[model samples]
Target: MAVEVKNSESQAKKRAFLTPKRILIVVGVVLALGVVGAIALNQLSKNPAFCGTCHIIKPYYESWKNSNLLANKHAAQGVECLDCHHKSYLEKAQEGINYITGNYSEPLEKLTFTREQCLECHEEDYEQAVAATEFEESNPHDSHMGEIECTQCHQMHDKSKVMCSQCHTFSWFEELDDSWEIES
Candidate 1:
């Protein structure tokens, strides 16, 4: 009977430590910490300085600094690095692992942006941009060439170019050059 009492006392003591209230408090603390840590990491990763940590990204950072491209303008306007360079957390984690292992590709492949991505922010000005560049021979934004990717001519961190010049000639090219230079 005494041994049974002792065992019961020990069990009660153990249960005291893991009472429902205590368990709830511990879980709440852990969840709060997890939320805070995730928020901190996300903010840190969104910083442009964070992107510059990789040596291969230096050229892009420098170009963003000097270029009159939309990316630079957006940066100046307080857009975060991740706003455009968004990746899933898993993808980002894998990339981080690859970078640490020196398994990433050399010459760091250029990041690509889709027209839809650009349109998200520029949708209001899409028509205006197209109209501004409209030429008698072709409406660069509304013609068959419109199907071409925005990145083909609209470099984000470098001098934008007219990819059409490689395959076609137009008098408007000179006008575009003059206007772009003036805008710069």
Candidate 2:
């Protein structure tokens, strides 16, 4: 009877160490912590100041501060850096590695934004923008230029130019103070 009691106690101790409930509790805690950490890091990365930490991005941050470009205007309107600069976790990780290792391009390539992305926010204003400028010459938005990329002339941080000026001379275009003036 004494031997049986000892064996049962030893079995109970072994079972206690490997209990399914205890293992599940540990896993749950780990997953919860991971979720919270990921959320915190993601929020931290979204700050414009955080982006400014990268040397390559400092110029962009400064330009955004000094220029009255769309990016800066958007920031003023409460849009955050990541609102337009979103990338997948894997892509961000790869870029981070390249930046840390000094393997990035000298002039970091500009992020290309799709027309759809712009339209997502500006769809309602598209017609108004096209109609705002009433030059006898065809409205750029309604004409051939409509098919071209918005960024071709609508720089976000720097002074926007009339891309058509490369081929054609529209004196009125030169008279415009800024690209945003087209809407005025």
Candidate 3:
């Protein structure tokens, strides 16, 4: 009788230990999977190809193909999509939330770069772009004083500005396909 009771107690101890071991194995597997998934996602986001994988971004990519910035070669060489778009921690958080919620159809304005966003690198030009035309120009000031945001003249999405012909009496865009052909 005594021997049977001791063996029963030993079996109960083993059962208790097995439960914790199973729990630990499950937790470890879950953590490992999470790490692997995070690494894969980080790599995908870095690829420009990954950005264009979505159908919604096709227009943006096509616009970039025709942009002056693409012809610039210098700016295109250094600046990636992230350079202007993901400048702030808050912006990163916003992006994460958008991904988490699977809301890919947000307004283009929200995702598009603003004049303020580009100022991170173009610090010198920020004042000239935002400042009144009087103080900004070196030539004898003759034009009307219009305080314009960088985006006013230049379309932030394409990094292109209006043609001189758009405001003037010339049809420069008839043959020359410049970045911005003046929005109609």
Candidate 4:
């Protein structure tokens, strides 16, 4: 009976060592980590630093710092870099392509903002601005630069909107048109 008991104990140990359950548990852990790693990699691309990695975006980073919209502490507090820039996975992918191809390069210019991009958060603001009867009549920016993109003037990170007077005094234009007079 003692010998029989010893043989049974050894058999039990061998079975436990090779069990399917143990193997499955180990595989599950590895697969879970792989899934998590993939997600992390995807998120990394959306980071503002990641966007700045491309030489094309470096200028945008600098200009955004000086913009009026970016300087607005209230907007900056609630809407972070990703909130305005990386709203969706599709946008992230598009950004990657844009960075590589240098497409839409001019929007990075100081005192500019992408109206479509800004409309995402300021939907009501955009609607009001667009629908206003003054949109055509008193739109100072439109008269000067044709139609301006909101993002072209507004920076996402710094949230600054460059005023016309920053570079060109109202008098400069007023010299050309009496209506360009400075307003108090």
* Candidates ranked by lDDT: 2, 1, 4, 3
Highest lDDT model number: 2
**TM-scores of all predicted structures:** 0.67, 0.70, 0.57, 0.41
Better of 1 and 2 by lDDT: 2
Give the residue spans of candidate 1 off by over 4 A: 1-39, 176-184
Off by over 4 Å in 4: 1-16, 32-77, 87-113, 127-139, 158-168, 171-184
- Comparison by TM-score, 2 against 3, better one: 2
Model 1 scores worst on lDDT over the 10 consecutive residues at: 175-184
lDDT of 2 by residue, 61-102 (tens): 876666678778777788777777878887777877898999
Least accurate 10 contiguous residues by lDDT in model 3 = 134-143
lDDT of each: 0.75, 0.76, 0.55, 0.56
Flag the better candidate by TM-score, 1 or 4. 1
lDDT of 4 by residue, 1-184 (tens): 9999999999999998979999899899999998897688687865656655777666554444444434334334554455554447566667667766777655464434466666666778665755552432344445467667765544444433335655544433343322122333
- Per-structure clash totals for the candidates: 0, 0, 0, 22
Q: 133-164 in candidate 1: lDDT tens per residue?
A: 77788776775754777777777776677767
> In candidate 3, residue 132 scores what lDDT?
36
Model 2 stretches astray by more than 4 angstroms = 1-37, 178-184
